[model samples]
Target: MRPGIIDRYILRYFLGTYFLVLILILLIAIVFDISEKIEDFITRGATPREIIFDYYLNFIVYYGNMFTSMIVFISTIFFTSMLTNRTEIVAILTGGMSFRRLMVPYFIGTATIALLSMALAHYIIPISNVRRLHFENLYINQNTGERYSDIHRQIKPGHLIYLENYNPDRKSGYRFTYEVFDGQKLLSKLSSDFIRYDTLTGTWRLDNYTIRVIGTDGDKLVIGRQKDTLLEFKPDELSPSLYSVTMMNTPRLLEFIRAERIRGSEKVNMYLIELHQRTAWPFATVILVLIAVSISSQKRRGGMGFNIALGLALCVTYIFFQRVSVVFSTNGNLSPLAALWLPNLLFAIIGAFLYRIAPK
Candidate 1:
């Protein structure tokens, strides 16, 4: 067979199997999701059109892109193992085709899927998630209220703000305190009995406020009534929803991260995790394909069934590793880049080793 024809043939088979596997898996997922949310749909009066268009359509895009890499790896293992079982790989190898050359078609197929996955992740999926999440909020989940007690945040470096009780509906808080610190020592402190956002002036209206400026020698205290001062936080920012960062697209997420850095938002790591994962996953999928080909391309007694089970196990392990690394980044000291990409880096080494040892 001509190399071009064989490459095209192999590439076609890879892509076809990928879509076939993707559809079956997505359908199973949708069935389970619908069963779980059926009661919510009925009680919340979710129309069929809304269900199909707003929720599941966007649902497929988000969830499909999320698992695209895993599916591609599975597809690679399935098809390559079938070729090995059928002895097509043996024929091709004996017919002057090198093992490395055999990888060309698989690499092309995987690169195609990787680029599509990357596009969906950074550009398309976030937009889809917005509508999907909105539909869920309206029809399934409705917990929109934010934090109401003991709100603490750093609006900037060395600047701390606190509120005992905050009301998002009213855009105000009670028992508000603002403090300025210099290294280990407190420079000044401001306390308020009641505070309300002044929409007209874009500042805070403080009631029964006290200002204490600490000097090296002594502390100066001033008590005032109805003080007006500009604070960095917006009204909505007081009770930021934890998962709100996932809704923004790449550009918006970057801008928000920049603003949050200036505001010293503590949840910046979570946002960074999402940001890094988007680019990281597509590249990781490429590594996964290399591993898949190395393991599945060899003929063995167990055949395709063995490859399939082994592929599933490896995919699960990789995903679990990814989730754990994300936890480390968000909850532990690991930086987002290191935590997210570390799995890929480790797996790449494994892939290289396997590819080097695979039968030629």
Candidate 2:
């Protein structure tokens, strides 16, 4: 079916205003960001190419996704309020246009933007963040120091793993400890403080080490440690950011959540929150659009000016809730999914109520 003339007009107006407002807000943000980073770039002797291409390009995208809902709400308010104030909306309704039909174009526009934002956030923006964050750390923070060694994090149930000193240049950690436990009782402890791998033997050489084994009957045995042994652990897994929560994608995030739960780790809340929040964020586009349309569509004495103020306040409230919910998630008091999406669920209900009272 062909779209009516009103559909085209509404689509053009909605999308045009959306992009226009997005650009205006992003440009202002970019200007401010550049102003702040300019001194750092100058002091670090960074090239203009590095400053613009390496940093600001990704910086803009990160901020754009972060502020997407605000842009949507503000743009919708500006466009819808303009139509109401100019009497165009009334003219269209009088000319046999139902508000429902008029909303089709706006919804289409928002759906497109929502999908785009989702793809950029999930797939594209993260890759950019890797580079942008690297640039900031390397240049801004002057993090040219040598990478730390002997880094180990607990990976199993009631087990402690340690690395003596890892050499990132060689992708290896020397002198490792892998301990296993049953409840509060230690079942076995493997201590190798001078462990080194022999490329020729494909085995680890542990110098002056002892393996202590505990019996279920409360007995202990000292298993003599050999100068050389073989284990299946790879040093690269212990590298910085390899297992970092931020570096993990959605699947890995789920895997971490599962494994951490089995291990009884308390630090998995942040990862769980990130996983649920990524999925929840896309739906917010629709929620905010509904709220913005309902809030701004009614004609008022002050028109767009007052509507814009209200929209800004509502946007801030929504964002504030989003951040606050993360605190609950991090503290593990609230379910991660609920913590991330509670604001959207509540606002969606409010949006529905407001839409019902919006002008027909």
Candidate 3:
């Protein structure tokens, strides 16, 4: 259906107010952030150009996209509250517009924001995060280490490798062991005192290695001083930084997850949660808009602040659920898909209930 006069008017109000609120909130956020980190910026010799163009530019885009659902809900409640205060909602109702009809422009507006948000979160933001996080690591978090200890990886079907105290910068590890199994039967085992990547030959070199082969009658053993061979994984893959997950685009993230699964990484759930949340959170904007309209369309003696407070509180609850669900996924028995979308499912039910009882 073609959008008529009322739809156009509401679309303009909603989208305009959305950007306006985003700008206002982001300005205040940047101010507070600068106040908090100015000493680091100065001491670390961050040029003004770098701080403004490199850090804060990407910062605004990254964080602004991060809280998009909240921004969208706030925009919806604020605009709808203004209409309620002015009795425009009542007039529209009295003049023959149904509540469902009135929501057309709102949902359309939310779709616009949600699509934009998902595009950024999945593709654009990750690219910018590289620079933004790089700046942060150099200036703000200089002392942090990226060391990983006690690594295990499945190089292929029935083939597993283990290492102790793997270091990324050195591309090496200590006390390495490789085992090949056939079903429950042990096939062969290789042990090494140390393993390091040989950049020139593009192979992993093992020092003082011993290989044990299980035979039908007994066992065979082979010892070597220095040997270079393929190990099917890079050192960094075993110790992927937490920020690395957030900094990957959708396709790379999917590939990374598949690779981690093959490697039998324990943090597979964490990567899955990040991937699922990218899609689920953006789609949640539609449900949030419906809820905002339902609660904020009524005229209240307490005015707009009340609706805004209620909406923010609800958004906070939504975020809390997301956080808790993530913990469950990473540390408990919850699945990634359920963890990422359970809040949306719960709130969608609440929205339907609220819509049923909303002023008609």
Candidate 4:
């Protein structure tokens, strides 16, 4: 359906104000971020060109996606409040247009933003995050190599691997053990004192190892000074930073989650939370817009300032609730889907309540 003059007017105003707010907020954020990290950048000998192209370019997109909901709320409140103060909304409503009809343009504008946000979160931002994280790790804050001690994983069906200690940087482990099982019965086991990946052979070399084969009669044991074996597990699999999950795109993340789940990883909750959050975060744009319009469409004696203050309070509350839910999911027993969607669900109810009481 074609938009009328009023719809076009509102759409133009909303898009214009949204872009203006996005740019202003990003500029302020960039300035503050640069100021905080300038010493590190300079000490690291990071050139200005590298900072702009390599860092800030990704920085803008990453943060812009992060703050899209807040920007939408702020822009909606600002523009809608201005229209209310000028009595434009009153005029439109008096001409027999219901409050719901007036919301059509707002929905259109917000839907566009929401879809873009989802795309970025699910696909684009993860790609940018790779470079951004690399730059930060190299120049800003170095991430220590991930290490695992007393680690165990199901390398494949019925195959288990254990490491007393694993060092990612050296690509070696101490006290490595591999076991094969058949329906809760021990089939065979391999134990090693030290294991290191042989770069030339693309296999792991075990030093001071022993192999035990479990037979119906008894256990057969064999000892050796050194041996080489092929295994499905790799050093990279054993050492993964908490932030590494955020760097994977949707497909890779799903695959990783499946593999981790099969391995019974306790840290899989973090990855599941991230996967749910990528989709949940974008729908917040629509919810916040509903809320902003409901709160700001009515003119009051305190005018735009009153509406803006209220909007800011609600936005802050939304962000706080979101963070709290994430904490619950990550640290507590809350399911990732429920934890991530709780804020959206709660605010959606609030939006509906406010819309019912909002001025027509």
Each candidate's number of clashing pairs is 0, 1, 0, 0
lDDT string for model 2 (1-360, tens) is: 234777788789888998888788889988897787788888888888888888888888878886776788789999999988988888887777777777888888889888888777666766787778778876787544345555555666577677768665454455767788778777888876566667777876776577878786775655554667666554444553422565455665677668666544456676677667666777798899898888887799877899999988888899899989889778658888888889999899989998889888
What is the RMSD, in Å, between candidate 4 and the native fold over all Cα?
Answer: 2.2
**RMSD versus native structure for model 2:** 4.9
Segments in model 3 whose C-alpha atoms lie over 4 Å from true places: 1-3, 198-201, 214-219, 224-230
Report the lDDT tens digits of candidate 3 across residue range 47-131.
9999988899999999898888888899999999999999999999988889899999999999989999999989998999999
- What are the per-model C-alpha RMSD values against the true structure? 3.2, 4.9, 2.4, 2.2
In order, candidate lDDTs are 0.88, 0.75, 0.91, 0.90
**Order of models, best lDDT first:** 3, 4, 1, 2
Ten-residue stretch with the least lDDT total in model 2: 234-243
In model 3, the clashing pairs are: none
> Considering only N, C-alpha and C atoms within 3 Å, which residue pairs clash in candidate 1?
none
Candidate 1 global CA lDDT score:
0.88
Which of candidates 1 and 3 is the stronger one according to lDDT? 3
What TM-score would candidate 4 get against the native? 0.93
TM-score of each: 0.87, 0.80, 0.92, 0.93
lDDT per residue for candidate 1 within 1-360, as digits (tens), equals: 888988998999999999999999999999999999999999999999999999999999988888888988998899888888888888888989999898999889888888998888888888788878889989998665554888777777888888999988678889999999988799999999999998999999999999999998999999999988998778867765535666778998898888777666677798888899898998887899999999998877787888888889888888898999989988999999998899999899989999999889
> By the TM-score metric, which is better: model 1 or model 4?
4
- Give the top-scoring candidate (TM-score): 4
